[model samples]
Target chain A: MFKLLISLALLLWVNTSFAISLIVNDSVSFSPDSSKDIRNIFTLQQTHWENGNKIQVFVFPDDNDVHQQFSKSVTQMFPYQYRRIWDRVTFSGTGLAPTIVNSMEEMLEKVSQTKNSIGYIENIDKHQSIRVIILQGDENEAQ
Target chain B: MKHNKRYFHASLLQKGLLSLLLALWIQPAFAIELADNIQVHGFLTQGAFYTSDNNYNGDSDDDVSFDQTEIGLNAFWQVNDRVDFSVQGLYRKAGKVENGDVRLDYGMMNVNLFNDENNHFGLRLGRIKNPIGLYNETRDVAFTTPSILLPQSIYLERSRSLLVASDGGQLFSKHQLGDGWLSIKLNYGNTHNDNDEIRDQMFVSYAHGDLDSEDGSFVGQIKYNYQSDKYIFALSYADVTLEYDSSSRDLIPFADGTARFSPYIFSAQYNGEKLSLTTEYYYSENEFKDFGAYSPDLSPITTNWYVQGEYRLSHKWQAIMRYDESYLDKDDRSGKNYEAMGAPGHMGFTKDSMIGVRWDIRPDVMLRAEYHNINGTSWLPNADNPDRKETKRYWDLFSLQMSYRF
Candidate 1:
């Protein structure tokens, strides 16, 4: 009985550590106006503010662990596949790939300042400037 | 024409300054977080090729020797989560055309129809690459097969009937099937031009692949093509009839021979981290009918296949070797033949065995030097005069090509 309790505790700890949360600035709103259902605040396609406006996007840089998790949860596509798809899109004159931002603070600041932007950041503290868009998994369970 | 020239000059100057400024700006920005929402990137490739037999024939004396150069540029821009666009341009010079001629290889808009958590679908329409073979699909500068030289059997030089662009649409869908994944692509469109004397020829091909991992994969494709990739493969069973004016009627031995033809191909490819191989077999048969009694029946069968291997010596250099052979059966004369001495010649065989080295000057550019020993029997008729034949025994051919992508 004691061994079972210890093992259950360890599994819970592992699951929590691996669990990822996506966050966005509160200013952005869910839009039926755009082709998709949701949008985030970002700038320059990265998480930077361009003239005090935030941009929006789908993925992050190569080294960010949170970015990797977010990508897996949201698109189920790896960084390589995402990049290839973006490359094809860009070369075909379709649209641009999303920009990358560093740190949650930068993502928050950029998103708060930008309009019609979208992005994903780690959820920790709730803020007035951003809102957490609930994501559902393949099982339709909210992540 | 004058206004177009002026616009071209002005754009050239503007692009030069913009590129310089972009390079400077991007260098400092690299340290920070990448911008979000939208990103702009592109690549350019320029290359030169020198061939021993410029005429593409075994006869060296007819020597139409020249240097060939080509430049390709590709750009991509994403609008939002579900929409994107890309444009590619190519400039090529083969013989003494003086100024290089430019053509748009791919300019298309892609719309993501379904972008769910696990699945995505996209549709593209414009001047797109004809995805007939494994290598032909990725003919763009950024994506290339392992070898420096694509298999000539499919991507033949000067064969616009094959490897050319198509004004069409393609639909692609991907779904995660349990542990592995599957992708399906369907393409439908018309040929760019009626170069083969056949008008409004339609092409349809299907490709499917399963991803085992990042480093290895298998893909298969089937296509019905009317154009010749390199040297004509005679295994096609489609009907090809030539449209003849009264003046040219005497030149043709058969008055009722149709000029329509069709070809069927089955191809497969496997790619590993260090090694890749692709092999294909094609069959085409031309039938001539409604000709006079003197018309002879000619049936030809052609078989073509090539195997290539590559070893990455380092990040910047690689070595490759390829062996290619094609055989045609000329003795089968079920179709109409237009000669008094029965069929003009027996079905012949051609072989090109080559070994080459490629230097990756950069990710978007490469330089290759190759040597090929070519041996062949029989000859194909020239476009101008069908009665004349050009055949050769064996020759040593040396070639050098530089390819780049911007």
Candidate 2:
């Protein structure tokens, strides 16, 4: 009984480690829209923001664990589906692919420094460089 | 002899493409990092095929052939919020038909006239890939296609150059439609006017000449994606007319004529977590008129379709099965009437069943193998097998390919 309890606690701890949060530059000045809208932006269907600023998207590579987690939990999609969508648009010359960063540190740095930039990281660290863009359902609770 | 001259001319275009490709391939190596918004990507693939009977992608009868390969490089730059530029160059060798030709696949400048939270309106001008079915735009990319060779029923490999891309302008809009997203595109341009393979295969013994695409060639497609991008449905249409300029030594001496080809396609797909199902149907009304000799006025409505299912067994392994068919005349499924029209019975239609596996060895590298059991020789490329009598009614083919993209 004691072993089962400890194993369950360890599993929860591992699950928490896989959590991801959406982040954007401080200049974005926009709240996360509906899930559909967020998906469109990431899929390159929506090229610009409401304020006429070109949306610059950054992301970790497809094989990254954090990237997969963010795609499922936040975008509500699998990595292959997301990659297929990007490949269709990119290879067809209909749209551009998002910039790929090598590491989470690079993703954080690029998203924070670039204007109108958006990305996700494994954790939401308190820093002046980045601001967490809470999702639609979590916005009120976060505030 | 006329076909030889045309091939020579086409090879010249290929040469120019090759030089430009080289420039692009080496430019980035020496150039400084332009900006964070500038991105360059490319892919390379080499394929080998073997056939029990008949020939495809080269003379693959009872022997393996490595006459299929593709190389492409593209770059994109976001100049600003409303404007972006993109260009891709391709070098492909598909047996005697394509022959290592380098071509400009697409070079377009997109201007986002209006963009908001839910609406996007854009205009693009240059050589653009025609949005026929789901796979037409990125058909050459091995990673993007379900198989190394796409379904020939709808995506005909012969006469591919004419249908792939055009030089013109396009206007597009993407907006929210109820619970799904709707995308509409309209384009008008001059077709890529390569008539060698078309004349060789489509005309056969009936006629021979150079085909020149006249004005007023256009294409359009409308697509809707359901919530979360699970289900997608699209309809596309294209109308292209080519003028036949006859040579003196033609099989049937005749005056100049016009060949008008128009095809309508319906496409749908359901994408799930580990399983994906897709299908597309095509109907084409093609007419040839005014060739004053023994050539009779011919108007044939060809129909074709394919059903494919893919299951991802693991992160690195995937399995696929598909059934594809194409009929030269829907009314004559057995081709008895077509055969009576001086064409071989096997030319009337083709049915193919295929199974394949793909293993992604790495994020950028992939290896794949597939087997095909084909009935009828309707889609046999004329360039590879110039003599029709040599083609068999039933054949089997196995293919292996490796591709890498960065």
Candidate 3:
């Protein structure tokens, strides 16, 4: 019983995390209205931007803290679900998986340099070149 | 000439896949980065199986079997905005069927005709995996599935090679529905019919001949995802035709005959944060006709289904439970007709209850183990069990697999 209680407490603690920003390349013109579009972009269902630039998806690894925050709080999905989608699409040769970066620094760098790319980070600095996409849903605000 | 040409191509594919497997050994998964906009990925899986009272994937009855192994290397190149090309080579071993053979899994050139955030259209030409169920295309890759063994009632190993992939073209389209997306795919091509397991399935013990399906086959699916990860639904359909030719020297050889299969699948799933529920139903119509003096004309309507639940213990561990069932003739649930026709009654159906656990030891590695308590022997592959009468009605199977992917 004590072990079960500890596991439950840990689950709740992990479920609660700090917010993360949905960083995108500044060249994208249209903004996503709801969390569905954001989820579609990460899952590779939405491939191209309004301006015709192909969507280059980037992400942290499944075990990353920022990734856990972005997945649970923002997209309302688990990280393993994203991994499942990516692996299924990749191995079947139907689509592409997201590029994995090491840390927030790498995430900021990749999203800033790549064209029409999208990723997330815990915090953005003042001079970073990437644009922050604010979701309109009732979830959580940007960190 | 055509037969020889096909043999030549198979050998070429074997050599290519083998050399690539050797080349990728030195450079591990994480260190090797090919180029920008061009990526290469690969995976390897090894499994050992132990079964009581029946043979599976080897002589596994009361013995440990190591016949299940798969290695694959795939490369993808995105050429500009509208087109991309991808190819994969595979080396797989599963008992005497698919015995350490190399195969060209899929090589496709995809062209995007039109695309936006809400709508997209595309075409893929070359060898491509058939979009049968949600898991058929990525079935061999252990990282993509729920357990070491997929539900046998729906994804039967006995006739797997026939439905693995096709050499032809496919058209795919996606459209935004109410807060979700609906995708449609249509494929028309020729599937391989050279597998001995399939031949064993189509004929009786002493009826030695060959099975061919040079004619074309058709497969299509319509799938809908609601809220991206909340609810999913799909419907898949396929029609295949196989022909048999008798060899002169064979004893008890029958004349040329034809067999046809038309199957429909209904699939649904619910994905929550900690738990996932999946269920699928399969209904098929089989027809066998025009074999002089073999048996009688037969048509069996088959049904199969499975329901499963998975729970995540943490990010790195998960558990699964499933109940699967299959019937060759729904009217004869006890297989009484088969028993009347000189085969075991249990040969016409199978019911399996399974439990499994998975551990993700690292980001690129996974290990899974499963145990199944099964009743009946309808889905056992013939290559592993040459005589149907030797199989026991009640059996058990345990398997463990380790996989590496990047």
Candidate 4:
């Protein structure tokens, strides 16, 4: 009985450590009108204002690891890769890089205040002004 | 005037009221959501240049001048999941000319033929950079290379004569191979000069036999890039030939006097958190059919090499140094005899070294200052004295430039 209890405790620790949760505000809808692909959510330029009236975006700083991971998942590129792509685009006058914010709190605040702004966070439960977009599970039920 | 003032005041008041209402309406009618499509961005830069010696020859002593000031605009519109249209435009001053001539540098349309996880293929038409070396491909206003002065060996001043900036079309594709990438580009087309006199001269006098015709020579380039998180290396090869009208002009023929050039280059760069180093070297050979009747056989090979290093002192400042040298065949230098009588066998050598600093005042703006010491073993027409022979000359060059991008 003691062995079984210890094994259960270890399983719980592993599960909690590797838990992958995509945090969003509580009010965001997963329906088509308010829904978007991960690519669209990460790369979009403008968002609805936090007062829920207009559009704009909240961006990750250039050196942020979360931004790097987000870009990697969406564009399949690293920070430098995106930088080179953006550099070529900007230099040629074809597109611009995104605006950056410093911290997750800043990102959350901006996204909450400006409806058009969107950013990712590790902890979604603390923010009351936004809604989380439900992400479907993978074949392995990883999410 | 009073009536106009009243009208203007009324209009201003109306604008304020409309803006307030629009803000209010926008606040609630729209969910504070970001647009999933459409983007706006640009960059700007300004800088100055100074030459220690009056390098301008007979030109004015204003050793300092605006090095670069440019603005760019970019728009990317997603038509659908698989298709998007991208366009870019730029306005900047000429780099080599004495007068600060502002011109549209690039306006191109891009269509992503294919964009996959590990590979991408695209078609670009309009003004595009001739991708020769690492810097030439990204020499836009927003991308500042570590070197204050560009590598002159491969980035020749004469490249403009051979390559097109916006003219013609190019097909390019990149394939990702694990930690490396391979890119292939094929380009064809002709650039028509606005100046009739210059165009005619380039075709009839400057070009080799039958090269100046409507069918300009074809150019092809292959580049392989390998990058890990900290280090990067690139290898590239390019060949170009221009045809001239030999039958129409008074031509002096030597053996195999066709103007043909093949350049092979290798470059490597390493970047640490606070330091970066880059090195590049190129070897090129040019062949002439008949050495202006002076020699039945004359060929010259030019070798150029440079290494540069940079260290970041703080968040906003950096220091850099570079050494560059060009070695020409000392036997085939150009002169009145070489030009008029056509001596196919006169060549000279030149070497230059430079150091500089860069201050990033902001993300879109930077200030740069550099100094160069140049030494040469031959005499150029623009030198202090053309009649002097076997001379070594020295000069000091100073320049300051500011660059910004949006």
Question: Best candidate, TM-score-wise?
Answer: 3
lDDT of 3 at B226: 87
Off by over 4 Å in 3: A1-17, A125-143, B1-32
Q: Give the winner by DockQ: 3 or 4.
A: 3
Per residue, candidate 3 scores C-alpha lDDT tens digits across B232-340 of 8999999998887877855566778887889999999999988999999999999888877765678989999999999999988999999999998888888886676
By TM-score, is 1 or 2 better?
2
The models' CA-based lDDT, in order, is 0.42, 0.78, 0.78, 0.47
Instruction: Sort the candidates on DockQ, descending order.
Output: 3, 2, 4, 1
Candidate 3's DockQ is: 0.49
Q: Give lDDT tens digits, candidate 4, residues B196-294.
A: 222222222232343432444344566654442245566655565533344433344422234556677777776665677888888777564543453
Scored on chain A only, each candidate's TM-score is 0.52, 0.72, 0.73, 0.47
lDDT by residue (B191-212, candidate 2, tens digit) is 8877777776656745567888
Write model 2 residue lDDT over A10-118, tens digit each, in one string.
1111123356666666667655544566677788777787799998888787778978877776667788888888888778877777878878767766775678888
Every model: iRMSD? 10.6, 2.6, 1.1, 9.7
TM-scores of the models, in the given order?
0.56, 0.88, 0.88, 0.63
Error of 3 at A127 (Å): 16
What's the residue-level lDDT of B64 in candidate 2? 68
lDDT string, candidate 3, A7-124, tens digits? 1111111223364566665555545555676788998888888766778888888888878877877677889889888888888888767888887767766666676787877644
